[model samples]
Target: MLRLPTFQLHEPASLKEACALFAEHGAAAKILAGGTDLLPNLKHEIYDVDHVISLAKLPGITGFEMQGHDLVIGALTPLAQVATNPNIQKHAPALAQAASLVAGPQHRQMGTLGGNVMLDTRCQWINQSYFWREALGFCLKKDGTVCHVVEGGKKCVAAASNDTAPALMTLGASLTFVSATGTREIPIEDLWVADGINNKSARPGEILTEIRLPLRDHTHHGAYGKLRERGSIDFPLLGCAVRIDLDDADCVRDAAVSLVALQARPLLIKGVDALLQGLKLGSTELDQAIEAVAQLAHKKCKPLDNIPGDKDYRRRMVPVYVRRTLRAALDGTGPVHHI
Candidate 1:
């Protein structure tokens, strides 16, 4: 059995104390949230840190509320709540669908929304037992220089496998960060850099405080589709999210498509507005636009052989999932997932 590395666990009573502890520990400290991802990584010896700052004592970061035109969610809110919350279902069904599809009931009960957002990039080569990785001489993500996914590759390409990221991106979300220094909020797009070795832009002493999602006055429809090996307890081989806003006449006003499990960052498919704009629901024009968007996604998304599934197969399923998700959005039937 894999064993977690030795570490000093620090549970702070408040954010002030937590930030101070982080500031003191610097690079040697790692934040512990739900322990869904972090603990497993620790067992695999992915991170060797001296201190683990637990947020269990921190308060006021575990619920959902509406602040003006935005749906503000506490970072520590359970995934089960996010999946079943009535407000989230009304305003951001795609996100709810994504949350519901995460792992299983027990995992959802333990996993937090913020934990899902901050999930690490995953790769088949690196996410293994120490002995298995040692036998293969490791890869770029961990203690090795070589990248097995690509021949002589210089950068790590571990795919981002978070289900909620694409859904939140399509919902036009932003995140708030707090530290001993102060607090700052940024669009979710800014949270990620392209490098898989260390993808987040969050600073060492910062704690993700909350997530904000904008609410529009227009009619909205959304869906999430995941391609995976099993219905539960499996991450996506390909994950797609679709969002389309309509006017009173049921014509498209704005649209977006975002995907994960493709690369180091969740991909926001480009030129979606150009194809989907002004198309009426239930019309041939809308159907044609959906097809065009799927084709466009297929052309833009290139899956590397970093995750468990066949990369080429994953590539082919991108359009298929995207198309199905878009259709489900229009039909008011959601989260087009395999069960």
Candidate 2:
């Protein structure tokens, strides 16, 4: 039975208090949201923290509602609530689907939307018992100098395992963060960086507060697809999220495709809107457009041999999953494949 290290726990009654505590403790403190991810890492001794700041008591960070034309979701909102909320289902079905597909019912009940969004990068070698990793001399993501997946590699290549990030990115979401200094907002895409060791762009002492999504029009449609080793309790091997806006004639006016678990960060395939602009669904050009998007994804994605399944095989499936998700988004149907 793995045991967590000794630490001082702080229960902050409000966001301001939490920020103050974090500012005082600095890097020695770790934020505790759902504990689904952080607790396991603590037990495994993957990282050490002298202070554990709990956000359970923080106000204004536990629910969702519409603020004028945008949907404002508190960072501490539970994944289960996000998955089942009527507003999320109607306006951002891809986000709802992604949240629902995270881990299982119990995890969804405990995991927060912010926790899922801030999920750490994962690799097969590093996600093991302390003794197991100690025997292997550790990896760069933890306390080691070298990355086991890449010989003599200078940087970690752990894959991004978050589900909702891609979905939110597809919907043009922005994140609000607070710190001791002040608060700032940026597009969700800006929250990620490509490096695995230090993936998120959030600064020290910053707390992710909320997610804001733009209002969706009737012509907007979106879908999410994930490939995992199991139907539940498994991180995605490859995840795809797609959104398309269509005109009266069903021609695609704009499109976006975001993929996760393909790299160290969720990637928004570039030039998708340009490639898909003015293309009508069910037209001969549709297949070509899909293929073009798939090719672009293939170019951007460079999965390392750090996780389950053959790296080459996973790369090959990117196009397959992207194509399926795009079709589902356009047809207003769930993605055909989930494996």
TM-score of each: 0.98, 0.97
Misplaced by over 4 Å in model 2 are 335-339
Relative to the true structure, candidate 2 reaches a TM of 0.97
Instruction: Please write out the lDDT profile of model 2 over residues 234-275, one tens digit for every residue.
Output: 888898999999898989999999999876899898999999
lDDT of 1 by residue, 1-339 (tens): 677788899999999999999999988998898889999988888886999999998989999988988989999999999999988888899999999999878889989999999999999998888888999998899899999999999999998989999999999999999988999998998998898888889987998989999975539998899999999989889999989999998899999999999999999998998899999989999899899999999999999998989989999999999999999988988989877
Query: Local error of candidate 1 at 207, Å?
Result: 0.8
Best by lDDT: 1
Give the best candidate by TM-score. 1
Q: Rate the local accuracy (lDDT) of all candidates.
A: 0.92, 0.89
Task: Itemize residue pairs with steric clashes in candidate 1.
Answer: none
